[model samples]
Target: MKLPDPPLNQASEIAGDWPLHGLAEDMRPALAQALARGAAGLATIISLGEGGPRPVGAQMVFGMESRAGFLSGGCIEADVEAHARACMADGRPRRLVYGEGSPWPDIRLLCGARIEILVERLASDDDAARALLALAEAREPAAWISDGERRLCAPASDPAPTWPGAFSRRFDPPPRLVVFGGDPTALAVASLGAQSGFSTTLVRPKGPIAPPPLAGVAYRRDDVAGAVAAVGLDAWTAVAVCGHDEEVDHEALLAALPSAASYVGLLGARRRLGARLDRLRAAGVAETDLQKLRAPIGLDLGGKAPFEVAVAIIGEIMASRHGQPALARRPVSTPDGDGQAAKPPGGGKS
Candidate 1:
């Protein structure tokens, strides 16, 4: 269904910071409020060039005078908000480009990159917004297509429109991190995961030891296998087993290995990893599948504290998610044909 432009006069300026916490799930409350007030507008990043601050499909929900998320760095939000107001006034979608050679010569993006934003006015009961929310809840990836006269959501596999000026943007579910175990380390990792924009969940088996309180993280009390299934691990999900219990770690690994999870990490020393692998193989997990597991999970950041380890783990997960090499190093050969390090990865002395 096509959404009509909202009345520009209906908005009133409100004072507060943008409520964004870096996840689409965090925008639900603002979206619902804007829709209920009949002042909702959708702003999305349709295209982003090299070095762009935000990736394509990043979006925000705007009310007449309030915003709930961010589209770019501080450089472009004001202009995008102004265009959104215009879209509401005219019942039409507006496309805005910012960055190098932009019409506003005075405004320069810090990264000197280009981005395209599409703003569309939405009504209180907009079907398109509802559809997008449904897909998000289901954790399904889909394409949002608009051709001026109509707006619709389709499967991710749908072909893009060939018509001139038509736009299609794909939206995927937010990345999820499921941490198994209720130890202090697990709590720290879960906290870091949430702060880093992942939908974080802490799962631990029911026992006499109570789980620690973790703010902004969902808590689950179930066996490892059940918890894995409950979280609905997808290709965007990362599972980390942090408990010291071998049985718990083994069960979590078994459950996660068969899934399409982008990362499966086990927290322990190198020695424990070998024993765990042996158990997993004895339990019928294939050797090739075991290769996907990251034992002694986390980058070698040389920090032994719980928080430092958590940072390393989250860093590795982010690197894996973005397809970046976890370690940055230049290899050098010694006279004996053995490898010698010139400099440590991520800028450090050898």
Candidate 2:
């Protein structure tokens, strides 16, 4: 199915309220509401140019009364919302563009980049949409494809089907964070992890200690070693052992090291980590596997507070997830001929 060419003169007004950054999982509630009301539209970024505010596959769901997710750095959402409303009215998908030389003269994307967005009418009962939602809800990886007229959803492990003039987007399950501890520090890590889009699970080893409040986290109670196995670590999972107990830390490390988890971090001092590693080696864990643990985990942010420590740990996890170096390097300023430091160009945050 072919999409209708967008009208060159079509323009949209500004929407005052911008939505928050979120993934497909976070937008499920809004999508469900939209579907129930029979007035929902989905806008997806199918293509993006260099320096675009948002990457390809970024999406937003719009309901008659509310919207969830974001498409850009707060520049084109209003216009996108207008296009989405139009799609809901006509039930026809259309491609919209913003930024340099855009057809919509009223919208000027300040990011100095271009993006192609596809807006389509959506319903709760849509077979393809429901399939995609189910995969996301289950934290399963999948790929979704659409040709504006037709949509297809496939498991990530399956070969993608080809469709001429279609755009495809891969959706991975949200990164899973397994925090082993019931302490305040572990609670902080889980809380921040949840807000940062991780499917956080707080695992407390069986004990007299009470569990932390689980407003946005999954609570698991098991022996430290058993909890690791119960969580079923995957390549997208990160394990953080924050308990100060030597035995608990050692057991958690043993389970995490041999798993497919991309990151395994333990909170402790250098000497403590050394003792733990020795214990692991004596317990039959291979030296090579023991080396995989990030003992005294987190970058050296130098803050001693629990929240600060959580920030460092989360930051390190993100860097590791993206294959980034352990240490962040700041741009070095060069001296100009006049003996003044030359400032970097376009220095503001993106």
Candidate 3:
């Protein structure tokens, strides 16, 4: 797409509440909205040194009247926006440096790290922007390439960087959570997941006709298997089973265990894990898949409140998504038959 010559009138800056480290897909929606407002610019971190607050490929969209996303932890955004406005005005690409060897030495990063950001004026009909927004809406992976001026996008085959000097990024669909439960803990998890930028869906069999008061979470009143099928599990999806009903939990586990979901968690007493595993094994679940289950469902944060448990659960999911190693914990024995274990005191349900 060709750049528009001559900048439009400077519109009043309207602040935006966007995530600091939002995903590539997350930036697309705001970017589209910003483009719709006339003149807009895209600022991206093309390089980073040690101790940088955000990673490479982090982006911020600046419009004539609005801005979204963030480049730092509130240290250099104002300066970045200034440079972005200048680039928009000149219709030229600029490479900005900060922390070290920066033209503006006054703006220092608290982390004492250096970063290189590419700022360029982007047209509303830019091919890269349109492709990215369309792919994000369709929940498809895409590869983006830009050299501060020209931009290109295509369906992603291998999501790895290719071009040398230009910015290359692979955009994946946002993480998703399919939670099966309607209790307070379940509601808290679904709500927190949605707030945390996840595509969240809460499935409660025979639930109330009216949906819960949560804002971003989608409600499903179907059975576990049906809900799983309808929602469609993916490698970027997570499943949390916390119905507290034995049969319901078991059914949910059965449906989730053998799926493409990256994380599958079950909420229950640690002692009862063996019985659940045994049942799952007898039901023909592969041993490898059974090993993927995270029983007791969360990091051992020792908080019993519903929101606290939700925090632990979301923390664990984030850890998994970032490829963090699982914490060491005692293993459950593989005793045969449906052995019963005494449920412990209220710790957000057994």
Candidate 4:
């Protein structure tokens, strides 16, 4: 099993929102190390994926003959590093689809979740630093992110703007999860939120009560639209209706749908879920968007309490973010002597 986190620094927690892949503002070190990848004049494309153990923008670097990203998990990095080196030398952007089995018959990843990563080699750094820095400074509305072979135009709009031309890797801006309501469950839910690697703003009628003494929690109580505007919601945010009250949760969910949050979850039992769904359907939330709200708000991990329930909810959040089935499971086991776990089934790389 992956070890429990030592305890996140309040100032440096990660997120678990959509665009999933686990990212933390604290990832500065990994990113800094990654920048040195290729060491030459190669730009970078850090493919963000929801399904992987890493954060969505958990960046790995591949330029010409070098790599710096953690290989999926420890089990997979060496091979990834070797191939990344070769790939950088090949002089062309690559869309490597790896999962199930191994790059070779001898190697393997226990879990078989196929990942499509777009690896591009470009002469960059000054350019990326410029664009990213501008975004950080709140200058430049948006910029066209180019990785030599392709151009991903990120307009200042929600969902930003990305061209899904095949790629093995790319970076994703953080996904926002705006929560409303402040109750006992509020802090626990927010606690779960912290682990998600998302930029969460705790919004209550007043503000975050006591600011919740939990790791990775941020408190910001503002009007819904104002909050979204301030935090900048986008396609990746998954708004959860955990604030308990119907009026507040309803308003918040409705407000978020117009923005780009990909998922909306409601915390309630069957009767409540049905009632809320019926009301939302009547409210013209667009069947697609309305359908996005997970009325039941969690997987059935058999936890009756709110905190336990929060865990289940986080599970569902993970599944939704990764675009996996509502019940995809990855059972872990120790690796064998040869470094191969129970091998998953898949043909060699296509």
Candidate 5:
């Protein structure tokens, strides 16, 4: 069965002022009342002139009772409430940004991302309201909410014919992980990938067979593009090469590297996988494209066994899934005269 979709929320940084949980709670009754009357309730969000502190998939839902979709840890809800109340009072649409790189400690946390948030006054006919209605009616993840500058849109399996909302964010299909090989380590890694909320395909090269813990998994054939064909793989997906067969690993790498999967990893130590990369590149993979592959996958957890190794690998995948900053992976550089040197970030940087 498919996984339940995550709720949608608008970015606070896009709307100048962060949304207040208390304000949404307070606003709920009025909005709910509007919904009760069968009238349309529209909500619009955009990046503030700068940015807000929220993840890409954050959301805000305005029901009759003013429910908060996903919010910042409720740190600055008071200010957000005041902003919401003022917007309701003034009957106007406005733009605001928390930080412009100045020293506003509250707004400008050094998170490395810029934010811009927009809160526009919406009536029944507003596009955002209509699109939101579509999502609400069908429980569709098709609505991609954007703050104008940076948008987050996820596709829906069954979307309504027309999206009556006025929001434009690049709609991205949900991310998936394509796991190759049918060994215990591969299964363990796939199991952890499922836990991290990725669509996984367990490829058994020998033929069709079932694994033990068949929960939250979608097995696939070992042929080329099997995972890609089974479930759509965009730049968000991560492909990992595990299992003992070098032949199987090579085929999986050949299939995955060129695709749009965001992260490509091969489960092996440095020396072994490094040779594979060299061969793939020598076989015509570009230098830049070759850089995208993550060999010696996972963090250096000092792990030594299958489960321990799986743990480290999963940690890396988790970091990649959420776009988390990668930890340093130590590397050794060979000098021109055959000398070697230690590089920055360490071996686990990939």
Candidate 6:
């Protein structure tokens, strides 16, 4: 009942290995694709000790001739793949230990961390995979539970599994970005956001007849409220108002602040933020919501250039998402021997 290995010549044609530091959502599509090949297996890091590069829930999908996702930063993927192939051959689940106490003493991890992986053959009509993909498409949270053989996918709020030796993980929707602007800064933010793996959209009111020339970015010309309604803000969404127009920026902020977006930022001078906040208050935006606004948007990276600002903006958003504190009052060295304190942009593009 063993599955045959691919022909030797096909080795060069088979492609595999993608960096593993991304949302599980990124790995699920590859898993689905592998399933379509009729023979697929999954490898998951079920346990991890200190100093491991990837977290316990990291996963990789294997097809007959290809594989995707990373596990040990390239230290153990080939061996893991070999184990997955063996599991697929016998249709049996396997638990592999590497690093300390590993049966394969020669397979040492550079980080010197011990880890355990579970390899299992996945049926083409796997219900858990289907449910997980569906939930991801709907931008909802899902919980995946597995016992090395059986698997289940349910809403994140579902009760904990009582099954013995089961491993469970919760997956939240991927981060999304909605940029309200049509300027260079806006384009840069949208472009960088898309490249950085956010489901990115650029909303411009009465913008050019043609969309901005950026790949992987959805362009919307609707008014701020209409754009917000269409985008459907969620807890994982980030809104940036950088139109540089007083009225338009206010409109975007006014619409975005009341939504469920996890981050709301406005690009302007810190001094002008008071006036903007006053206008928003006059328009009935609650103080609690206003407090969430990141005025002079970005991490105070002391850059005035469009791309620089975009980096700071995206960095700040990611930091907020990851619960990291934003960098503050950093000092930048000027051409003169003296160092000048870097400050967030007061006005104008860098």
Whole-model alpha-carbon lDDT for candidate 3: 0.78
Q: Residue-wise lDDT of candidate 2 within 223-320, one digit each (tens)? A: 87667766788888999888757677778888898888888887775434455676788889876676667656776676757788789889989898
Deviation in Å, model 2, residue 164 alpha carbon: 1.7
lDDT of 3 by residue, 226-344 (tens): 88888888888999997878888888888888988999988876657777798999999998888788777877777768888798889889898888766533333332224332221
User: What lDDT score is found at residue 136 in candidate 1?
Assistant: 76
lDDT of 6 by residue, 1-350 (tens): 12222212212112473544333335777877888877688888888989899988888888877677778766777777887888889998878777886755566677989888888888878898888888988998999898768899988877756477788888787779999888888899999999888989999888887988998899998787788889889999999888866778888888888889999988876556566687899999998898788766787678788899899899988888888754532221111223332376424432
lDDT of 4 by residue, 1-350 (tens): 11111111221112332322223433333334445553322222244334566543344554443334453654344444444454456645544444542243233334545444444443346455445534534423344454446554343543544455422223355555666657655566677777766667677755644676667666766666676667666766667667756676777877776667777666655434556666766887776676455545566565556587667666677787778874643311111123221222110111
Regions of model 4 farther than 4 Å from truth: 1-69, 72-125, 132-168, 208-210, 281-284, 326-350
**In model 1, what are the clashing residue pairs, if there are any?**
none
Pitting candidate 2 against candidate 6, the one with the higher lDDT is 6
**Prediction 1 global C-alpha lDDT:** 0.70
Q: After superposition, how far is residue 300 of candidate 1 from its true place, in Å?
A: 1.7
Instruction: In model 4, state the lDDT of residue 211.
Output: 72
lDDT of 4: 0.51
Q: What overall lDDT, based on C-alpha atoms, would model 5 receive against the true structure?
A: 0.52
Q: What are the lDDT scores of the predictions, listed in order?
A: 0.70, 0.73, 0.78, 0.51, 0.52, 0.78
* Model 6 / residue 95 / CA error / Å: 1.6
Report each candidate's C-alpha RMSD, comma-separated, in the order given.
6.2, 8.0, 5.3, 14.5, 11.2, 5.9
- Model 5 ranges off by over 4 Å: 1-57, 60-171, 321-350
Candidate numbers, best TM-score first, in rank order: 6, 3, 2, 1, 4, 5
**Better structure of 1 and 6 per TM-score:** 6
Better of 5 and 6 by lDDT: 6
Candidate 5 displacement at residue 213 in angstroms: 2.5
Q: Distance (Å) between predicted and true CA of 119, model 1?
A: 1.6
Q: Estimate each model's TM-score.
A: 0.80, 0.83, 0.84, 0.54, 0.52, 0.85
